[model samples]
Target chain A: MAEYEQHDHDHIEHDHMTIPKYIGIFLVLVVGTILTYFAATVDLDFIFPGANTLVALLIAFTKMTCVMLFFMHVYWSPRMIWLSAVASFFWLAIMFSYTMQDYLTRDPGVFSP
Target chain B: MSSHSETGKFHYHEPGLQHQFEDMGQQEESVSIGMWMFLVQEIMFFGGLFTAYLVFRSKYPMAFAAGSNHLDAFWGGLNTLVLIVSSLTMALTVYYAQKSNRNMQVIMILLTMAFGATFLGVKTIEYRDKFNHGLVPVQGWNKRIKAETNAEHETKPCWEVDHNAPAIEHPNPRGEFQWTDCSLVKKAQDEGYLTNAEKIGYFSNGEIDANKFRDKVRIFYYLYFVMTGLHALHMIVGLALMTWLLIVAWRGSFSEDYYMPVEMSGLYWHFVDIVWIFLFPLLYLLGRHFMHGG
Candidate 1:
């Protein structure tokens, strides 16, 4: 595999997001943020025990995807760019998995708990 | 870096190209790819802290929740809103930069910088408040200061103040707890929700054991400072980059043909925004409702 791409970046149509579309995404992001704030203060745990972290993380992930796909122009990007974006998360997962192996399974009281 | 001038194909050569690439499109893609690579490393850097935060927060849910609540959600939430708006302007700046619209591009970049400054401003206020209360994670930081300060709002609790103009709570044993539900525990005890032994274990002299909470609270501040401090540092870097871009844009540097700087900087700015999107919930919103009892 080549380190650099061969495709003409200029020849390719750069489907830049329209101003209105960017505004719409911004509105959604704002609303999603407010919702994330409120949802944290609600007892989602009552609905399903220990789901607050899950709900919070899920919302965060959604917001992250929006930013990446639209704000970062990932949605209009080519395969290499998309793969690069996914690669970052993949690397993050590696860090999380190995680290959590020790953290989640370790003795909780080791930290003066 | 190789001399990009001599080795290029029959190309739309721009002023910024090094002696390394085939053409402008390839050069721009290379720049974008390089930025993403840097961003990947950035994710790892922050990932280390997030992992530590997760480990500790899980180990000390009560302390973490209580510590998280000490932070003013209004400021954190307002900063989130501010950053998102900044991101919109940033994306617009890049868009106009690609169109070579100098006025809109400069305006949007300025707006983005203003928003970024606003975020740091709000952060400075929060940091000052924490410092005033001695919430610094290192030496001279009073680990108990937050709980101590929050204890003064015993009747209304700290959050009730946030619902209003959010008057500052003082240091007093009775005014304890920022989460609304700690007051509930007090209420439950008052109305006799617990058995005598439970009351004895959970409370002593009609108050929760604030001493038992010291270490966890300290850990919370450690995570808070490491994460948010690093974030603020990134904002500072972004602001510096924006200042550079603003100066160059003022000199009629970027155009539809050569706007790599604007695009790359926008990516950096958006990456910071995305990190905050995750950070806000993890740091500010984690366990907010469920840990209300904390």
Candidate 2:
């Protein structure tokens, strides 16, 4: 058992993420949460119908970046993993934008006939 | 270490590579690719709901605004904070697991579970409050304004000359009126539409309104329940995964080399947390403009 453990230990690096990095990520998320709440309380309707949504999405995107880069270890991962992650988001955008274009631009009056 | 050397230019795969993989690097790449593919499908799942929200909000902008105002921001904000904190703990757990610190991994996993439970508990309180007030979207429970008046007559023996005296006209008998029992059945009852005792029983028994509310709120609560409830369910799953990981961590299953499971699970948990971050604002904060009458 000990020999197997030693053999396993030799291949893996023991030190990458440290306590400071963890604390830093935690602080960033905390700031994002606070900002989201603050933005929600403000009246941004004059800007657009979905201004709050945009703000919220921006914060969410920031939070996701933190998670993907830090928690998922994509920063240290090979290029292929990073590319796959980016590709997933690209496909998601295509799916969302295309479907929403059809729904948002349709005239309700067209169905009356 | 010299086994490869003694084999004389052997091109063996890395030990971590599964039997079917061409090499260790290929195996890692495949696993990462598979996870990304799964995440893409998750995006599509959430995308369908987002599209629905867009269509509905555009159709009934005012109604959607009115509906969004009903959600309490404090609870929503608190839940957001809780999930963010939990994500931090999950990341830390993976970090410790990678370091071969079994004790730290267990501690962080337990902390993450505690945060997850806190979020669900707060959500339960919010749901109960919505049900108590007739904010739950149901046929009769949607919105009902009831005007109740009570007259209390006290007769003193010396002050009353005639026992059969005409009842004094209390023009506006102001009694303690509350929004008590303002549900679908009570709304239907006040409307005087259904007189059948059986029908009244059906409505008044709380079953009909509850069902109506379920159906009506089904759209809102469907999204609400489906999204928040699904997020809560994910939290539960994360807790279970953490427990299993914790047990293994306790047994020293993860080391510097073998902590991929812990790392991958943490990534998933963090993604779930990020979903809630978006959900909080979309569901709870988008319509604050209508709160003060738009």
Candidate 3:
């Protein structure tokens, strides 16, 4: 078999991210942080017990989306890369939820004692 | 160095190949997969603490809310912004490295390290303030210092006036009455929560009275220290990695095809920033809800 030679393409056909896209992601992250802080200050007791947690999780998910899509270059990469990351998250959710079921159901005072 | 134009396919099986890998792509894939696995483990590590926080808060909602109010949101917000900026710089560093721009890569990495350091510095200031104000959890954990000070000053007795003088005098210039050191411990000793032998040992060793000062609230401080300390350690490790990368980058060791190390390190740095994004709100902002009466 012949050795494969590296080819130099002056015009690389890969999709490149623009500076504006990066700036847009950064702006969204900033807005998300501010909104999270604002949400924390709100009196949402009437809404639910963990309203703040829910709002925070939503903001965190948004931020994660921005980071994964833009900073990690996942959007520019092959479909396989994106699939792997999503798979990892899926596994993580399974692990977290399974353990949390047992944890949430335990005697509340067990640890305190 | 062989030019890519001279070869049809990039020769990645050079001397840098680790013993475990058959080829470059496979090695790269395995390394990335392994890193992802480690990151998953890290998630679980932090997840356990988060679950604990949730359980305790649910059990003692009032105490947790009260604890939350004491956290200053301004610092948390500023730190979030700082970490985001660091993430941007880190991403830029990877971008520049991919383009084989050595100077830009070095500059971006340095900027990222600077931001990480700034974050740790701010965190140090916040932790120190908490320590000095006795806001740390132990046993007899002092409540919010500002609120307590206001309350104490509002009811302080006038020293120069007669007993019949007005009950509420001018705000005490000295502010809240400082609790006498170890007095609570002495009270605890009198109450039999602590044996006389333990009291003697505490007094002799200058150990704080456990019974009087037993603020289980200290548990919060313990969590604060563990989480923030672990985060800070990650930042430190990132800074060190960047510093090493800076030296190599300055020496012009990387090119378009061989910038994988820098790219991988950037991924790690960005992950750290992501952790801080979650931590800032959970640790600092969550408590701000108490400021408005429920």
Candidate 1's C-alpha runs over 4 A off are A1-9, A107-113, B1-16, B141-209, B290-294
Scanning candidate 1 chain B in windows of ten residues, the lowest lDDT window is B172-181
The best candidate by lDDT is: 1
- Across B39-99, the per-residue lDDT of candidate 1 in tens digits comes to 8889888888988887766555656666777788899999999999999999998888778
Per residue, candidate 2 scores C-alpha lDDT tens digits across B1-294 of 012322323444343445565444455556666776676677667767777776555443433444566678899999888988888888888888767788988899889889988998998898776655554544353324343355454343211223245533322222211121113333333544433322422333544433322232346555665677777887888888888887888887776545767777877787788788778878887767545342
Off by over 4 Å in 2: A1-15, A110-113, B1-27, B136-218
TM score of chain A per candidate: 0.78, 0.79, 0.78
Candidate 2 chain A — worst ten consecutive residues by lDDT sum? A1-10
- Model 1, residue B63: distance off in Å is 0.6
Q: Which candidate leads in TM-score?
A: 1
- lDDT, model 2, position B106: 86
Candidate 2: residue pairs that collide: B138-B213, B140-B184, B141-B184
Each prediction's Cα lDDT score?
Answer: 0.74, 0.65, 0.65
Residues A7-104, model 3: lDDT tens digits: 23311222375556777788899999989988887857569756787898889989988887788776765456666677767766776677667655
